[model samples]
Target: MGDDVDRIKSRLDVVDIVGDYVKLTRSGRNYKGLCPFHEEKTPSFYVSQERQSWHCFGCGKGGDIFSFVMEKEGLSFPEALSLLARRAGIEIESYRRSDGSGKKTLFDIMEEACSLFRTCMNGDQGSVPRGYLDRRMIPPQVRSSFELGWSPPSWSFMVQYIKKKGISLKDAERCGLVLRGNRGPYDRFRGRVIFPIRDITGRLVAFGGRIVDGDGAKYLNSPETEIYSKRRTLYLIDKAKGAIRNGGHSIIVEGYMDALRLHMEGYPQTVATLGTALTEDQATILKRLADEVFICYDADQAGQTAAIRGMYVLQQAGLSVKVVALPEGKDPDDLLRSDGGKARFNDCLKEALPLVEHHIKLLSPAIKDDRTRKSAIHDLLEGLSNIDVTDVSPYLPSLAALLGIRDFEVLDALERVRSKRRKTDRSFDTEEIPSSLPDEGQQSQEMPPLPEIALISLLWSECDLRRKCDTREVVELLSDPRLKLMASSIMMGESPSSLEKRWLEMGETFQLRVLARGGAYLDEFTQNSDWKWRHFCHLLYRQKGQMRYNELRVKMLKGEATTREIREMEDLRQKLVSQKGS
Candidate 1:
């Protein structure tokens, strides 16, 4: 643990971390800006003097730099640790080695498994899966670049081979490769073509195996173990992140084939869940890459359900989710298979419907009735209300038109819903409201405001800052957790003695993804100057029941707490205490 902390500290910077998701401005000893983790109209996100920490006045999600990556990116603790550790050029080998000295963690074993899978795919025997790829119509360049492979059907292929290669059965099991039963360990992915799934950092954390028999489940995916979760991964993120970032958009399709084929066919920015419905977590990942997401699903019922789910999640994350409705129940793969497949796919993409239109189409006739219709339309409006309306800027006129009203009306309705929503975000405590406050529990459960999601969307772009300002003093004064975690990772990393050394360690590709995401955001921040500091203070004060203070006595005793300073210190201190309690 000490080693991990040391490594993360040396590597991760609060500036780069906070900057990756929040636009910041240097003010005195810290950097200040809108809280990226929560919505606000003023700059509250701050990066500290030491550049080792950050805090926000609005959202309370704070922690060390590693926690920032872990939460915002949906990565596990060890994964975050390894990522930042690598960035710092600190490679961790186990204290216990061959002589019971050099040890490896769960992440190490997973990496080894991924490599072994890759080796098999590159070998002479790999021709089978390679042939399979060809049969599937994927280009060879894409095939090799993706390292697509097949796991030999034999139960002992990976198990026996890996053990022979010096891995302990325990390590293999921990990596989710071979499962140990009463008799012995059996390979998890037997008789299947294997596709290694890597996180954005390019680490091999999971696998997606397709049945070679062309039977049963067609595709058998890796189950969520300690290391892998379907909700948190996109099939081709490692390759597609750059494409998505540059395009300011992404193509989310159904199945591994669609992602692979699309990338192979010039659309390198495409990605997909592993043959499953899109999840909120997945949408979060996509949104982190680009401001817009174009979804292409099979035009079937299941596809619609998946599309709707994607729309809600992507929208909630502040991405403009446009639905590309394929004709005749065809998926991207199906289109690529048909005559003039690529053209048809491109046409559909060009004709993609904004989420509002898609929602209308999905719930149209069903919502034709007056009463039930309101509920249905309202359901979609609520979803729309969750979107970062800032993302809707380009499409606002169209969106407003589609909302069947003007932009202000849509904005007004969204504000009303959001206003009522703030009272219930559970993100804030309202114990002080007393009995006088109506328990609008029924109406308050709504999501946060969407209109201001532009600020929210900035979190995903923090890594993209174009110009760096000295924000040392401002980051110091903030008290929000989300800000702190993000700040630590972004700011601290930048202040380290050897920034390039640390970055070089993470590999060029990774360095680019982190920078690309944050870089774009940083650019936007410098341009907006649309700070959100005071708004954040408002949220913080409100969270504490807009307290009637013993401010006079405390400030007198403390001898120097400005109202802002006193309130902030109290808020942060309470948070630290509560965290310890929890």
Candidate 2:
């Protein structure tokens, strides 16, 4: 496995892989581009052809070719490896082996089941579903492209088929195509029109079955399995990602048919949420692909509520969100099927309201009524709290006007609500500590500091620094788990290339963060190892001092500070102050 990884690495240049996603230009010995992972205007993302790695300083994400593909394409390590291996023209036999866990086998089973379903749809057994599709005006080419299929109405149809094919019933069940019941294994999607669900990489993972004439629910999706997660999967994402990236936005609908209709109607940048509330994982996926999202769900109360909830989720993920308010009593599928519907739908897209304004428009009725005004304001405040204040500030006057309240009053109430939310998050009754501690600023606790990243990079790259520096205190000062592990490895004399290989196995986000944070300092450390070492040591000591100061402050707040501990706290505070001054 390692040999295959090394071969892939040796064959593929990180610059070429990343260049496909980001526009790069020469900057010194490296290439620089705007980060695709975040909203950055300045080019803070850099690629090192010499090192065969890339990192985004703005978003603090960096990694080699494998991690780059994994992060950019939203793929797992195995999937990314397979993708890059194919590109490198190297066949990995071990990757194809089904090690009894059936991870790869599950994908094969889904493909086989999809073939069976398509065969059934094209055969005489599919007459009913075919007629239904014909009535819905879904063209043959569209149906063929989406691989629309039918499951036979008999209970044992797929079970018998799987047995005849000599595929394990357990593996088919794992693919969510069969279920074990009182009468052994049976088909899970009998009498339904099958919509094969593929991941972003176009590999079939699950199915969405819509019933034409059945006693069961109108639509049934395959249950969550080892290979499929609905929260992380978006219908038509595999097809729409390119358009979304090209257009710099995505259009989200609620159902599979809606996405298909929109795609058929010349809007190829549309995807569906599989008729569920939008999830953070889905939002994050969209964030990676586009900067804006337009939600056009069904024009019903439930759909409206879902759009509003999804609006906040997308907004919190730092994507601009808009709501496409469809006409009442019509969904995208129904509306697009009508005469001149496409033109009207285009107009709706043109006039889509920003999420905040759309949210206010939705609450207009309650805002007008005396009975529900206060409750409506409270709900609006809650929604607004989920977004950044700058994004919501422009709408405050409109909101205040609707409530017959002054703008400052509205802002004051919002602040109070935000404060309450912060208090709830803390969930403790201690008094606030003074803000005289080390200025960590707005950095998240999960993000490794630049000094820690630099120190680790130095230790990994400079053998003399690794041999001379006292790494125990630096390792103890490190907070990020991956950084601490790498630092420990370097202290024990791990080679730079060996560490880079090990680093590739870590999570994409951690790799990006560490690499982006520390990659810039490699030259500086290499040039003046003695000066850089001392600088990083001081930063580590200051970090340690801040951590200790915070711990003592917490103890003091709880009235449990001992005399020696209090003295130590005072000493650490002075030391941190002196260090900051210096």
Cα lDDT tens digits for candidate 1, 220-324: 777676667778778888778768767888988778888887876799998887766678877766665668989887788545854575567777766777888
lDDT of 2 by residue, 1-582 (tens): 899999999998887677656656677688887788987544678899999998876678998999888787666788678778766778886354435454766776787899999999999888899899999999889989999999988899999999999899988888888999987888899899999988775667889999888599999999999989999899998788778877889999888899999999999999998766788988877886778999898788655854676679889998999889888999999999999999999999999999999888888898789898888778888888888655765676798888788765675577678778888888685556765644434333345666877777667667887778676776787876668777777788767677667667763345545665566645534458778878887888777778888688668655699989978976775676567668
Local accuracy by lDDT, each model: 0.64, 0.80
Residue pairs of candidate 2 with colliding backbone atoms = 61-512, 62-512
Q: How large is the C-alpha RMSD of every model relative to the true structure? A: 15.8, 12.0
**Which regions of candidate 1 are displaced past 4 Å?**
1-104, 337-339, 365-582
**After aligning candidate 1 to the native by TM-score, how far in Å is the CA of 182 from where it should be?**
3.3
Candidate 1 deviates by what RMSD?
15.8
